[model samples]
Target: MRAAVVGAGPAGMVAADRLASGGAEVVVLEATGAVGGRTRSVLLGPGHRLDTGASWLAGFYSEALAYCSGLAMLRRDVTGTPQLVVGGRRYPAPFEPGVLARSPLLGPTEKLRFARWVAGVLARRRRPHVGPPRRADADRADRIDADTAIREAVGAAAAEYVLRPAFETMVFADLADLSAAFVEGWIRAAFDGRYRVPAEGMDAPWRRLAARLEVRCGVEVTEVRPQGPGGGVVVEPVGTFDAAVVAVPAPVAARIVPPGVPGRPAWLGELRHAPHVLAYAARPHPDPPPASDVHPAGAGRHRVGSVALYPGGDGRVPVGMQGATVSAEGWWSDELLAAGLDDRALAAALWDEGRRLEPGLFGLEEATVLHVARHPHAVPVFGPGHLARLAAWSPCPPVALAGDWTCYPCVEGAVRSGRRAAEVLLTAGR
Candidate 1:
C-alpha cells in the first residue's frame, strides 16, 4: 500500500518511519524547506545548532527517545544555585526538591501550602501496585483551567508568583486557558525527571530519518480528498495514495481536508491555537552571563512571556558571541499575527523586548546575530469542551490525523499519534 504523510514535523516523520518500516510506499510532504517542524534548528556557529523550538526531551518520553540511542539525549544536571529576578530584589529559587526547606524566598506558610497542593496532585497521579485505576485524561470538572486550579489548590499568590514564570512562560500559553491536568502532568513529570537535549541538537534524528525516506520539501499539500468509497485518496500537488496522514497543524489540516467529509467534526473548522514568537540574538558578554530564565511577568514593561539566555558554550558560540531566545507569553492575537507577520516592525519589537529582558549583568550591548520567527498556530489551546470537539473530529476516509494537535501538545504526543495513524492504516489495509 502507498501512504502520503502530510506536514513533515515530528508526527509526520514518525508516521513515515513506521509506514516505511512496515513495507508501505511512504512519501513525506513538508511545506517548509527542511524536515523537522517545530524541531527547527538554526546554525549557531560552524558546528553548532540551537533548537529554537521543542528544545528538550523529557525523560518520560521513553518510547519516542528509545531510538538513535536516546536521540543523542543526555541527562542534564543543573546546579541548584538558582536565582530569580523579581523586580529589584533577586531571590533564591530552589530547584532541588529538599532544598525548598531552606528557601529564603518562600515563606514557611507559603511553602507549606505549596507542598500540600503538590502532594495532592502527586497522590492523585500515583498508581497503587494493584488497585483500581485512575483516569488520567486532561478533562476533569475542576481542571478545565490551570490558573483557577492552581489558585484554588494552593493560593492566588502561588499561581501568580510560581506558576506564571515556571509553567506559563515555558508552555507559551497563559495558565487561565491551559488545561490544569496538562499543566499538572507537565510539572509532576519534570520534577525528578532526567531531561535531555541532543548532544548536538534536536534536529539530527529527524534529518537522519528523512535521509532514509522519500521526503519532498517545499511541497505544500493544498487539498486531500477521497476518490469515493473503495477508491484511493487524492493529495493535491502530490499524487493519489491508498492512505494518507494529515499531520499538519490543525488550522492547516482544516484547510486541506475537504469540507463535509464523512466523520469530520462540526467544530473542526473552529480549532483554536496560541501563536508563538521566538527570537534569538547574539552578543559579546562577560562571565556569569545571566540567569537561565528571565520572565517579564513581574519585571518592568515587556511584551515577551520569558527569555532564556544561551551564553557561549561548547559549540554554541562563535569566537565572542552569546545568544538568548525568547518565547512570547501569549502571542499577538490571530488577526494581529496574520496581519503583522510581514511587518518588519513586528520582528524589531520582539528583538527589542529580548534586549530589555536581559539583566544586563555583563554590559553586552551589540548583537551580532538576530533571528526572529513567528508561528501563528504554535501551541494548541485546550479550553472548555475542547476534548468533546476533539472526540467529535474525524478524518476523511482513507485519511488519518497526526501531529501534536491530534493528541497532547508535545513531541511525545505527536510521535505516538503518528505511529498510531500508521498502525490504523496498516490494519485496515491488511
Candidate 2:
C-alpha cells in the first residue's frame, strides 16, 4: 500500500515512519522550507542552535522517545535549577517535592482541595469508564475529554496559584481554555517519571525519523481528494497514495481534508498566543540560589518572571530567559541601566562564562532580543464542549487525522493521536 503524510511535523513524521516501516511506500509533504514543523530548532549563531520551539521533552513520552532512540537521535539533558520570584523574592522551583511541601504557592486548604481532586481523578482512572468512540471504528479503550480544569471545575483558588499563574505560563496558554482532565493526567505522569530534552536540539528526534523515510520538504499539499472508492487520496503537488495521514495543524488539515474532519475549535482559533521575549543579557551579579532551594515566581517578584538558569558544565554557562510577566513596560533593563550595571562588567560575564557555552548569550553591548509570538490559534485550546466537536468530526476518506489539537496540546498527545490515526488507516488498508 502507498501512503502520503502531510505536514512533516512530529505527528506526520510519526505516521510516515510507521507506514513506511509497515512496508507501505510513504511520501511526506511539508509546507515549511524544513521539516519538524513547530518543533524545529532555531539557529541562533553561526554554529549555535537553540530549540526555539518545543524545547521541553518529558520522559512521559515513552513511545515517541523510544522511536527516536531506535533512530539513534541522542537524548540530551536540559535539567537545571528553576528560580521562582515572588514579590521581589526568589524561591526555588515549586513543582519539586520539597517546594510543594513547603511553599506558600498552595495554601493548606488549597492543597487539600488539590489532593481531593487528584484522588477523584485517580479513582476514575482506576475504574476506567469509556465513552462512545469518536469514530465508529475507533478503539473502545480511547478516553474522551475529562472535565478537569481548576477554574471551571473547582474554584478560584485552584485557578489562582496552580492554573492561572503557573500552568498557564508553563503550557503557554490560559487555563480556562486548557483541559483540566489533561492537566491532571500530565501531573500524574510527571510524578511517575522525569522530563528531559533531546541532546542536539528539539527537532533532532524528528529529523532522525525523517532521515529513514522519503520526505519531500517545502511541498505544500494544496488539496486531498478521493481518487475513487477505495482508490485512496489524491494529494495535490505530491501526487496520489493509497492512504494518507493528515497530521498537520488542525487548520491546515481542515483545509486539505474534506468537510466533517474535525478542525480546531473556534475558541482554539480564537486563542491568543502570548508574546515571549527572551533577552540574553549580561550581569555581574553573583550566581543566584539553586532552583532546588528557591520558590516559584508569583506576583511582586522580579519584573523578570519564570527565569530558569541551566549551568552547562565544562566551562559553559547557559541561562534560559522565560519570564513574560509585565509587558514591555518597566523592565529590569531600565532598572539595570538605572542602577548602573556597567556595560563592561556585564560584558565580562557574557563573554567569559556565557559565550563559552550558549554563544547565543554573548556580545550584548546592546540588548540581544529574540521575540517569539505564537499564533493564539497555533496551539489547541481544549475548551467548553470540545468533546462534542471531537466526537462529531470525521476524516476525509483515506485521510485520517492526528496531532495534539485532536486530543490535548502536548507532544505526547500529538504522537498518540498520530499513532492512532496510522493504526486506523493501516487496518483499513489491510
Candidate 3:
C-alpha cells in the first residue's frame, strides 16, 4: 500500500515514518524549502545557526525523547534564577525555595494565597469524576475564561506580576477569551518542572527523521482531494495513496483539504493559530549573572515581555556556544504582527526594548549578527469550548488528521496525534 503524509512537521514526519516502517511506500510533502515546519533553525552568520522556533525539547516530551534516543540534550537553568529589574532596581526572582517569603515580586500573604489557589486548581483539575458526574457533569471549570480564573484565584496583583508575564512569553492570549481548562492543563505541564533543548537547534531531531524518510521539500500542495470512483486519496498531482495523513496547521489544513472530505473535521476551518515574532542573535561573552530564560517585571519597561538565552551557543557561531537569543513580548510583538511591518523596523524596536532590560543581553558588546523569524500561525490557541469541539470528533477514514492542535498543544500531543493517524491507516488494511 502507498501512503501520503502532507506537511513535513513533527506530526507529518511521524506519520510518514510510521507508515514506512509498517511496509507501506510513503511520500512526505513539504511546502517550505525545509521539513521542520515551526521546528526550524535560521542562520545569523556563516556557520551560525539558531533555533528561532519551537526552542525547547522539554523533559515531559516522551515522544521526542523516545524518538531521538541518542541525540544529545542540553539544559540551561535560566528561569530558575531569573533577574527582574523594576524601576532600575534588580531583584532576584527565582522559582525556588522561600521566594514568596523573601522576594519582592509579591507580598507574603498574597504569595501564600496564590500558591494555595494553584494547589486547589490543580486538585480540582485532577479530581476524578464519580459515576453520573462523568456522564452528565457540567463543569464550570471548563467553561470559565482563564483570565477570570487567574484573577479570582490568585488575585489581580499576583496574576499581573507573575502569571501574565509567563503566559505572554509562551504566547500572547486575551485570557478573557481563552479557556480555563486549557490554561490549567498547560500550567499543570509546567508543574513537572523540566526543560531540555537539542544540542543542535530545534530542527535537530526532525532533520534526522527527514533524512531517513522519503521527504519531498519545496513542493506546494495546493489541494488534497479523494480520487472519485477510484477509492483512494489523490494528493493533487503528487500521486494516489491507499491512505493519507493531513498534519498541517489547522488553518492551512482547512484550505488544502476540500470541504466535506471524509475524515476532515469542519472545526479545522473555524480555528485560528497564534502569531509569534522572535529575534535571535550571537554574542561572545557569558551573559553577566542571570541569563537562562529571564522574564523582567516589565514594570518600568513594558515592551520587553520576557527574554531568553540558550545556555550553550550553537557551536557554529563565533561566540562558540556562549551566544544568546532575545525576544520581545506583550505589545511589542502583538502591535506589528500580521500588519506588514518591515523586518528592520520590527527587529530594531524589539532590540531597543531588550537592550534596556539587560545591558548584558547583547553579551560583551552589541550583537554581531541578528536574525528575526515571524510565525503567523505559530501556536494553536485552545479557547473556550475548543475541547468540547474536540470531544465530538470522529474520523471519516482513508484520510486521518493529526497535529499538536488535534490534542493538547504540546510536543507529546503532536507525536501522539501522528502515531494515531498512522494507526488509523494501518487499521484500515486498504
Candidate 4:
C-alpha cells in the first residue's frame, strides 16, 4: 500500500517512518525546504548551530525520549535549578528542594501552602473531566478533555512559583488559555525531576527519522481530495495514495481537508495558532550579569545562566539559546532589554560571565549568528475544553491526523499522537 504523510514535523516524520518500516511505501511531504517542522535548527555560522524552533526536551516527554533513543540521539544535561523571580523578590523554584533551599519571594507559610498543593496534585493522576461533568453527544462530536486552569488548581502561591514561569515560557500567553490537566500532568512528570537536551539539537533525531523514510522537501500540498472509488487520497504533486495521514499543523490541515466526509475521517476546521519569535546572536564575550542585582528591579533571572550556549573562546557568547518568552505584543523584548540583553551585548555578556554559569566561566568570540525565524503560531495552546474539540475532530478510515497540536502541544505529545495515528492505520491494515 502507498501512504502519503503530510507536513514534515515530528508527528508527520514519525508516522512516515512507522508506515515505511511497516512495509508500506511512504512518501513524506513538507512545505518548508527542510523537515522537522517546528523543531528545526538554523545555521548560525559556518559550524555554529541554533535551534530556530523547538528547544527543550525533558524525561517527562516519554514518547519523544523513546523515539530519540530509538534513533540513537545523544543528549546532555541542560536543566538548571534556578531561583524564581517574582514581582521584585527571589524565591526557590516551586519544587521542594528549591522551595526549602532559599527564597525571598515566599514566606514560610506561603511556601508550605505551595508545597501542600503540589503534593496533593502529585498524589492524584486521575485527570479531572471537564465540561458538563458527563460526556454529551456534542462532546464526542467535538473534542473533549480535562478543563481547568493551573492557577485555579495550584492556588496563587504554587501558581506563582510553577505555573507562572511555565506559562511564561511555554504558553507565552495568559494562563486563562492553558489547560490545567495538561499542566498538572507535566508537573507530575517533572516531580521525577529530570530535563535534558540533545547534544546535536532536536533536528538530529528528526534527521535520523528522515534517514529511514523517503522525504520530499519544499513540496507544497495544496489540497487532498478523496478518490471517489477506493479508500485513497489524491495528493497534489504526488498523484494518489491508497491511504494518507494528515500531519500538518491545524491551520494547514484545515486548508487541505474538507470539513465533513460522512463516511471518511475528517479533522475539524483550523485549530488556533499562537505567535512566537525565535532569534539568535553571537558575541565576542560572555553576556554580562544583569545591570540590576535584584531579581525584578535589576536583571531578569530568566536569562542569565538559563539559556543554552556552546563553550569555547575569547569570552564570546551566543544569545540564541536563552529561550526568552515573547508575549502576544512582543513585550518580552522590553524585559530582555531591561535585563541587559541585546543580540550583540547579550552574547558579549555571556562571554564575560564565562561560557558556563559557574565562577570564571569561559566565553566565545564573535561567534557568527546565522539567522532566526519567527513561528507566528508555533506551539498550540492546549486550552480548557480542548479535549472535547479533539474528539469532535476525529478522523475516519484512510485518513488519520497527528501532530503536537493534536495532543498536548509538546514534543512528546506530537510523537505520541503520530504513534497513535500510525497504530490506527496499522490496525486497519492500511
lDDT string, candidate 2, 1-430, tens digits? 8888887878888888777777788888887788776677766433335554566667657666775674324333433234444444544444554565676766777666766766666664443211212452332122332223454455565555444444444454444454444455555554443556665666777888888888887787888767667666788977878878888766666666665333333433443323232233322223423222122333332333343333322111234321111111123233333444354453342234323322223244433433332222345555444544566653333777777677556676677677777877777777
Give TM per candidate.
0.87, 0.69, 0.87, 0.74
Q: Which prediction has more favorable lDDT, 1 or 3? A: 3
How high is the CA lDDT of each candidate model?
A: 0.68, 0.53, 0.70, 0.58
Q: Which number leads on lDDT? A: 3
- Which is the better candidate, 2 or 4, if ranked by lDDT? 4
Q: Which portions of model 4 show Cα errors greater than 4 Å?
A: 70-82, 86-91, 97-101, 126-162, 229-231, 262-267, 286-367, 388-394
- Give the CA lDDT, 0 to 100, for residue 383 in model 3: 77
Question: Residue 292: error of model 1 in Å?
Answer: 2.1
Model 2, global lDDT = 0.53
Give per-model CA RMSD.
3.8, 8.2, 3.9, 7.0
- Model 1, stretches more than 4 Å misplaced? 74-83, 92-107, 127-143, 285-291, 298-302, 332-347, 361-365, 384-397
Compared with the true structure, what per-residue lDDT tens digits does model 1 show for residues 1-430? 9999998888899989998998999999999899889877788567556776777777667556764464555445444422455664545455455766776656788788888877877776562111111333434732378878877777765665556666666666777887666676666665645667776667667788898999999999999887898788999988899989889888888889877666445666777767777766667656535337665434222356666665665345554556666556565434346566653455556656655655552222365566776677777776545644555453343788777876667777778778878887887788
User: Candidate 4: minimum summed lDDT over ten consecutive residues — where?
Assistant: 290-299
Report lDDT (Cα) of residue 239, candidate 3.
75
